[model samples]
Target: MSDPTDAADLTIEQLAAEVGMTVRNIRAHQSRGLLDPPEVRGRTGYYGRAHVDRLRLIRDMQADGLNLAAIQKLVGSGGEEFVGFRRALATPFETGGAQIVAGAEVRRLLGVEDIDEATITRAGRLGLFRPLGEDRYEVTSPRLLTAAAEVGAIGLRPEVGLDVLEKLDRHAQAIAKIFVELFLAEIWKPFQRAGMPPEDWPRVRDALERLRPLAGEALLGMFEPAMTVAVEKAAERVVERIARDAEKGR
Candidate 1:
């Protein structure tokens, strides 16, 4: 058995298996600057946990709808810079800490005693929580779980919260598509056509990091007013119905 602390002991095949990636995909990621080259030891390159972590991060970003270009920019920053950039990108959206709890505990946390299995599956699909093993789950975001719990407390079914999240996921996907198209057209394409000199990589990375916060701010700015308008219209309709009911009662 290879010592876990000895990173030099892992072969390419072992690394691929550990990270759940194909060897070709790992090489592709290395070419795209999303991963570092492995250390060479007597004609064989040895990979370590860092490579595994980078692969996992890339996969997570892809799951979050980021394309390779975006992932490259984020990961190309290197070391502390990349860490800071990733934290900046995540700070706006995820405010609470995560918790790992058993599946039974998840049901308790969600305030659903007899939750349907399909509803739990849908919740996982919508990024509510990830299954840890047979009977455990890692709640990705406590704030989201709290919101679900609150909704359930208000007499709505837990499945209703999952439905709402599914709708929001659809809307988010649409918005992501538009933004990616705009970014590709306005930013990446022009840079590519300009010959994409090696010297320009840092500038591109900087632009991506800067835009991360700006995009978050823009989404919040847009969503707040839209939500306000929606709430106001709904309130007006409810008021009108109440007034009509009062007149009929009189």
Candidate 2:
């Protein structure tokens, strides 16, 4: 069926013509309780924007491979909650433009003299690069690329940088699962168990919208102190080793 017609009321036959449906089909929908009863003025029941909208929704549900019986059940059971859930799920987590760099530039950034086929394949597997052919790649996460470059500047080899990334990626995935499970258990399950109240939909969606940045900030906040403690411990070991080497030399 076509989109709901301009905010004007129409007769059943007029609505059928407007929405590309037969008059018989319109009556059948009304019989199935799929369409709302029209406003009756005397003997002739007039259809309105609401009727047009409901008809359009039925058409869409049918197009999505749902049978009439299923559509009836779904529409009878609050469909507004489904729409709210979809909107909440569609909330974006991250936003950034991808950067394309030549293979030579990539090598330079990683402080490598050359990039072998193996290195390219490994980077692709790690989701760091998408080969664009002709020796160019799309950097999936520019922030990660920048971090690799900084580490490379401090004399870490490209392979070593990739190794660190691979290990960190495993930890990152686990961290993501933790947050996702937390959301499902603490927020989503309660909402679902509550029968997904219409009025509470906004609160659920707002919680989803707030989750992403909160997760990011929490990770960074924890990582900072952890990194500092790790560095201090590593430096102590290095100093002890240097002192032992000096004693041996004497």
Candidate 3:
């Protein structure tokens, strides 16, 4: 119904049909304490917008792999707070957005006439790009493509950048797992074991939201010093080899 006033006029059968749910399912949800009982008038129980909203929320939770028992617990604890947690979890962790590029532009950037099938396939596997079936592609990270292009400008093949990216992705996944596991173990488990109190939901949701940027900042902070040390050692080895070659020639 367009108005909340009209929504209260809906019978249980009307509510089920409006929400695309079976009446039996609605009754089952009621029996499981997932749905609130409707207002009774004379011989009829009239459902309202709140019931419709709850059913929709339950449907969405089920779609996200939460069972009825979990949904009931979450709803009984406080549906709104759990919803906020879900919304926070669904938010993207990555900062940048993707862009679409023509195949010719991509080739020009990579310094290739025609990208080989294997390289394209490898790029797809790395989530670098998705083919749009008409000489176009959706690049997940334009910055990464630009970096590869810069590598090509220095006379290195794009595959070199992709190789480094593949390795980086592997390490990044491991690092991500560490951060997520840390949050679940240290933050979430304690809250969960405490019966997921209503008041703590906001704190838990806040922690998850705050973790998105913290994880990135922490990774970058750690990586900078490690990268500095690695570069220094690599440069030392290169200089040593060059001097040894010069001495041998003398």
Candidate 4:
């Protein structure tokens, strides 16, 4: 089987070559109705450029943990149009009850200042992030920079570390925004006063004090998987787009 010489007119041999299959194997697929016959260009059974594209898609689906039979059902059975819809049906883990993790605690754990406290302190003053306590500062706000600084490679300087944190600050904000909204919505319901005197607000407050942590517990179940899958799917889509671009230039 020859590789695709041009995108517009493809041969069975070319399709097999692009996808690393033999002509006999490709013919078998055609007999099984897994692939439609390409428009005849002459005496040859020509496959459209679309055939190559579909094969590539099936390869990717397999990598995503789908079996060959499932991939056939999806694309061969003309369910390609529903690919995105099927993806949307996936169960994303719910992420909830995320207590505002103090960035300072993360920094302390990552040892962001071990390389250069003086510089780190200076960066902090430059709005790196302040601690929530009387004398403490969190490695908050610019999360990206904090991460870089903490993971500073063996020779990475404090300045470079701060730069990483600055980058994170940008990306993390969008993620945090969604998380914050969900958190407050799921965990912060106000209690209705139940036949209590207007002056006795403390009773309601006390009830809420207990309710807060209890409510927080319920959120962990959702947030844990939600965030993980979102990040993964985002990365996968980015790479997939890049690959598509590369294929176009081929």
Candidate 5:
């Protein structure tokens, strides 16, 4: 295999071709300050593996629903500290908590003769199963799948479970937005205003990495009590309806 470091020799045109991007797009990124300027040798600029990697990283983040401004914050001045921060963030939050299972097997587990396309689409939206091919899927969370299977076994339609998942997804999105705004206001903006001193970049990265688990813990801590209150209120409503029905019968 060719040495990956040899990418440093590529010209702008070659680098753009190698990364499956248009030269115009590469120039656009440079103009937007999303990409660092290439190395200069007298008259010509040469791109490197770092540039290629950064381009790919930007594309991946775009696919993950990040806007260019969010991507800029994530790429973060192209320092080594930023690279480490990106790597840490790239690590799957869910890790080894899921598995790939055949679509037929998933249907069987759910006690369905054949799952409908709408159900599959809903499952995908819920991060339960991502389609791998015609009949294969990556189960994103086994625990979630188990809960769904239990609901199915208890005679609940998949639609009912999917409805609950839709509500959870909205709530999760709102919570994420709140936390990101907090981080931007309290942490990132202050650092930016101070010119993001190089010595402090590592600390900033560390703060972000530390926030991941803490954020997860905080969300769960808040969710449990909220869930308890919701369930209690629902149960109370059920009891009130039953009492009213008994009075009517009398």
Candidate 6:
């Protein structure tokens, strides 16, 4: 099947396969009104890319131990804002300080685990921990150090969080570099050579005043943790050197 995001149509079976769910299961959720199918096309009913995406999202949340009820609640509460919020939340917030615990009450509302200072701090520096107000933060840090630490706690040493943070710092730098260059080169195209008419200038002029920073955040924001692996692979030598240095604590 074509990419669900860009595809014109997807059959029930195709949607099921794309989302790795059985046709019966997909239909069952639809029957339960958990998901909605798109417009019917010809003999085969087709779901839009958004439907496929929502299904995949549900699948991932289910995999992460969210029950259907919780998913529904979470999804429903956001509504028109859901897509934007989900897209934003899809990427882990990056920070380099204990911003989360510094504002622990909010995270408690989201059932996010309380992590140590390193996890909080690193996430803050990465812009992963978003400040709500009065020193409160949303446990949306990109590192997810607490989640990883919880796993290790059940079996191995907790200090592994340090390694994760160190690795994240290196990867975060690469992402920032990519985002900075992309905006500086592409987004600034109109302003590079000349000025605009006073009447028509607001959009372009305001974009410089407004969108430049937001675009920087949005682009870097989408570079999820999984992309870090791509960075590692592309710079395998750098990874090796970083790894060696970590091994020596230098």
Please name the candidate that would achieve the greatest TM-score relative to the true structure: 3
What lDDT score goes with residue 55 in model 6? 82
Please give the CA lDDT of all the candidate structures: 0.75, 0.81, 0.87, 0.56, 0.79, 0.60
Instruction: After superposing candidate 5 on the true structure, give the runs of residues whose Cα lies further than 4 Å from its correct spot.
Output: 1-78, 95-98
Pitting candidate 2 against candidate 3, the one with the higher lDDT is: 3
Best by lDDT: 3
lDDT of 3 by residue, 165-209 (tens): 899889989999999999999999999899888889989998998
Listed per candidate, the RMSD to the true structure in angstroms reads: 9.3, 4.4, 2.6, 25.1, 7.0, 18.9
Number of clashing pairs per prediction, in order? 0, 0, 0, 22, 0, 20
Residues 151-242 of candidate 2 have per-residue lDDT tens digits of 89998888998999899889999999999999899998998798666677777777887888899999999999999999999999999999
> Model 2 lDDT vs. the true structure?
0.81
lDDT for each residue of candidate 1 in 1-250, tens digit (9 for 90 to 100): 3333436567888888877789999899888877888899899998877777778788877766778997786565443344444455456445467788887878986777755678767888887888777788889877778778887888888878777778888988897777667767876688678755555555655666666666668888999999999999999999999999999999
Comparing 3 and 6 on lDDT, the stronger one: 3
Q: Per-residue alpha-carbon lDDT of model 6 for 182-242, expressed as tens digits?
A: 5457654544344322333344434444544675577666666658978878799888989
lDDT of 4 by residue, 22-115 (tens): 8886776677676677777568777765677666666556656877676666563334433443343342322232223454554554455442
Model 5, span 156-217: residue lDDT tens: 88778778778888988898888778878888889889877667778777777777787799
Clash pairs, candidate 3, are none
The deviation in Å at residue 240 for candidate 4 is 60
As a whole number from 0 to 100, the lDDT of residue 169 in candidate 2 is 87
lDDT of 3 at 19: 83
Query: Which residue pairs show backbone clashes in model 5?
Result: none
Off by over 4 Å in 1: 1-98
**Residue 150 Cα positional deviation in candidate 6, in Å, after optimal superposition:** 27
Ranking by lDDT: 3, 2, 5, 1, 6, 4
| Residue 236 Cα positional deviation in candidate 2, in Å, after optimal superposition | 1.1
Give the lDDT of residue 214 in candidate 6.
Answer: 73
Candidate 1 is scored at a TM of 0.60
Candidates sorted by TM-score, best first = 3, 2, 5, 1, 4, 6
